[model samples]
Target: MKKIDERYIEVLDQFGFGLYTTTAGCNLYHDSSWGSYIVNFNGDDFVEMFIGYAETFDPNEYVSLHIKSHRVIKDIGEMLKSAKEIQILLLKVAIEFVKISKESMVKADV
Candidate 1:
């Protein structure tokens, strides 16, 4: 994904959405206090997720259904085929988000 800034990335532009997945997390790994995430596709390959802590820690929240460089989908079936991959990616990203937030909180206390 192309980095829009320190906190945002052009997810749609990166059709490699399904690449960052994990077995424990399908595509929706989240934490109650840290953050949440939802990486999926519709009109465009986008993400609705949050990384890091609250404004107190400068959270990185991505909530765009249609991000930059909308994909030219040739077949919906093709996308469906890779649902597992995408699911895994979502979980991985979400878990990472919560982990980062937790670590940050610990550091803040220190």
Candidate 2:
């Protein structure tokens, strides 16, 4: 498993998400109750961060966001060079994704 910043975990918690490492060694943050993933991290040197969404948060109806990477840092060496940058990128996307979700939900209710 790759080592991520503590703040990344904290951010996931604040958003009611859980982190899981896939069998293929990718990182995933998801909401189990909602049966949806918020993001996925794949690749080694040039990490690919996949941003996801769950607007209504329905286990059966939510459409997930899928991407190769929201932000890509290329040509990294063996030392996990872009951890901090990746963390910030992930956090920013997560925050915006959730904000959009909240706005959509509010509009839906009106």
Candidate 3:
């Protein structure tokens, strides 16, 4: 495992998160009741990538990527796919809002 800055762990804890290291490895827990997401340190040369809450947590869903190797997730194809998914989701939400606004306008005109 790579060495990370102490401030990184402090920042994680300041936000109701917890960090623990066991014989298995270091794991990051977002909340008291949530399962831990294992921190992978494969190719972080400058700053190590410790596990942290993804800004949002869904108890029902599992992490999509397990390995933290920079080469794997940082590849062009994977990045493109991730970006495409975000774009699709954004488009869907935008379309929904547009539909709602159009209905509201029609009702006002009537």
Candidate 4:
């Protein structure tokens, strides 16, 4: 598997989203929950981002941007398994939301 940083950058770049890191090493943005986030274990940094359309200006059109990243785990085989599992769960939920949104659009068209 690719390193976490490389994977993160690739995913974000592919989706055309920008990452903002705080002075304290946290990443902040809005997603499904408006405050959903993932934290980097190295520095306890967090990341979240999403895009939305303005109902007044573009009620019929919308844009979405998503970002996902993983923190480096020093002891992959031992120390941080639970953390990794939690991250995987979070990612799964995000993906499911995307799927549901797409399905809703299709149903609306029908």
Q: Which one wins on lDDT?
A: 2
Better of 2 and 4 by lDDT: 2
For each candidate in turn, give its C-alpha RMSD to the true structure in angstroms.
Answer: 14.2, 16.5, 16.6, 17.4
- Ranked by TM-score, the better of candidates 1 and 2 is 1
lDDT of 4 by residue, 1-110 (tens): 11223444444444333445554553422232222333322243122222111112121111111211344434333323333333444454345445555776798999
Backbone clashes, candidate 2: 0
- Candidate 3 lDDT, 1-110, residue by residue in tens: 55544655555455544666655456644322222233333443312232112322222232234233433433444444443443343344334434554776798999
Candidate 1: tens digits of C-alpha lDDT, residues 9-62: 333223333223343322423221212334322222223233321212211112
Candidate 2 at 100: error in angstroms? 20
In terms of TM-score, which candidate is strongest? 1
Estimate the lDDT of model 1. Answer: 0.35
Ordering by TM-score: 1, 2, 3, 4
lDDT score, residue 30, model 1?
29
Q: Which residue pairs in model 2 clash with each other?
A: none
lDDT of model number 2:
0.44
Q: Where is model 3 more than 4 Å wrong at Cα?
A: 32-60, 63-110
